[model samples]
Target: MAIKEGLRPGGRSARVQESIHSAVRELLETHQRSTLTVPQIAARAGVTPSTIYRRWGDLSVLLADVALARMQPDGEPANTGSLRGDVRAWAEQYLDEMSSEPGRNMLRDVQCSQTPGYCVAIIGAQLQAILERYPDQPGPSVDRLINLLAAPTVFRILFSAAALEVEELHRLVDIALGQ
Candidate 1:
């Protein structure tokens, strides 16, 4: 059955991917990223270790995919008309995610790993959403805006014990907007 399923397209592949991703998330809840093994993930996911290796090549690649999947926003960023409002809404969501224990762990693991591009991809998606709203306005570049909005929150998450204050987040948005 397993051999036949592997020979088919789409359906089995999708299920395997979903199962592996779920197993990764479930394991992350209790195990550190560095401690997770392919064999353990395969057991939890109900797939063979070869399936994971064949599909993802290595644990780093699998971890990258898992982090990217988890970082995907629940929905599109809110479009509140004004750029400031839109940015604030997005920033608030980003900060809220960063404040959670799971979010922090995911971010830390992804950032520390060789596959940091997953983190950058999430930020790029947010920047693209913001840019789509204001096609003509003269403002900071997408990269600059991403840096301005993300850097402070990430720094706080990495170094400080304090929660990111709402006012501070607004101020960061304002700074990004060059206000």
Candidate 2:
């Protein structure tokens, strides 16, 4: 029994870590970043502040990990033969993913003061990946169109509860393509 117990990886510590992370994520999704605190998270996780500090070092690091986990890299966009189709499809995917609870919480973390630099870097990488996904001659035009369409959706995601509907997407496409 002792050997079996010893052989069990992570034992209680791993469960504690996962519980803390899940609690943090839940708190972040429902509450503003400013409201998130070590004690609150620890209480929700049923652990002590010292346990969190010992494992993650600090609140910022712990929050960053939570945000990163929530923003797990989505698969790259697919090529649909035409830039317009590709851009629209990409926009759809981006909106769908970013509308999730974790995604919204990730945005909150980025906009909050805890890790502005890290957030900028992450957003930049996402933008660059978006640009790279559609590299064709009218590339600049397509990129700009994508930006114009995405900006408002991003605004809504960050600032309001407005859902991006298919009609809005179609309208944006028309405006972007001058149709």
Candidate 3:
């Protein structure tokens, strides 16, 4: 496995990393990213600050790592055998994820930090995977699809009080596909 910032792939070190990550997630649910401190996270994770420092360097690095980890999908989006079905499934899943408190918190942290485009990149990668399955179909490019799906969804999630309805997602997909 790939080592991350000198962290070994497994063993007690792996457990330590898991604990730290868990602590960060747990803390993030109730704490603002700017207010989180290494000592607080260490205490929550049952490790010393030096352990976190040794693994991730500082609070900013640790938060960035946590944000990136949270942004990852638990698994690949299901292949529904058709581009429309797959895109709709992916969009629904994405909407569900972003509507959660932790997801919003992570998005806020990533947006406010130096890695503002990190979430967009992650979403783009997911869209690219869906697009790769339909090489013969001619429609909007991956970037355009991302804009159609992500841009408005993120805006509504972060700004507007309105909920992202399922019909809206389908309409967006249809529009993107020129259907």
Candidate 4:
């Protein structure tokens, strides 16, 4: 049955890819990225190592896709009619995302990647998009402001497991806005 299902094309391949990505994510949840291997992912996905390799080439590419899926934002940014409001809303969203189980796991996995620059580039590109989306704010350094707001959440999630709340986000906004 599984083999016949695998032989089917189009939608079946998408489902298989999704399953493989999900299996990789679950494995990251249970184990460190350093411990992940193609064999482990294949075993967990109930597919052969050849299948994984045929689909993703190697573990890094598979892990990258899984990490991206895990880190995907829930929705577009909300504008509250003020720079402070928009930045705060964005910060809160980022904080919530960074604090999630899958988000934390993805961060850890990306950190362990041999080419961490790729992850950094992905993050930088997202930040750039946000700035492009909100151009009304007149600030000395928007990038610095974003870094300030995001660094704390990333730090807490990576090192301390601190629970981020709305108040903290508000405080960060106040600091960022110089208000």
TM-scores of the candidates are: 0.78, 0.57, 0.77, 0.64
Weakest lDDT window of 10 consecutive positions for candidate 2: 1-10
Task: Answer with 2 or 3, whichever has the higher TM-score.
Answer: 3
> What does candidate 1's lDDT look like per residue over 146-171, in tens digits?
78878778888878997678898898
lDDT of 4 at 101: 76
Per-model CA lDDT versus the true structure: 0.78, 0.66, 0.79, 0.68
Off by over 4 Å in 4: 1-19, 25-40, 43-47, 50-65, 133-136, 140-142
Q: How accurate is candidate 1 locally (lDDT)?
A: 0.78
State the TM-score for model 2.
Answer: 0.57
User: What is the TM-score of candidate 1?
Assistant: 0.78
Task: List residue ranges in candidate 1 displaced over 4 A.
Answer: 1-12, 28-37, 53-61, 112-116
Q: What tens digits encode model 3's per-residue C-alpha lDDT throughout 8-113?
A: 7789988887888899889877887778899999999999999888767678767767777677777777799988888899998888888777667666656534
RMSD of each: 4.9, 8.2, 3.4, 6.5
Residues 135-179, model 4: lDDT tens digits: 776542555765677777788788884766679778877877678
Say which candidate scores most in TM-score.
Answer: 1
As for model 1, its CA RMSD to the true structure in angstroms is 4.9
Query: Best-fitting candidate, measured by lDDT?
Result: 3
TM value for model 3: 0.77
Residue pairs in collision within model 1: none
Query: Model 2, range 1-179, lDDT digits (tens) per residue?
Result: 01012223476866776788899878866897787899999999999999888766678777766765556556656567666676677678768877776567666654533434554454445545645665663444534554677677778888786768867987887677566
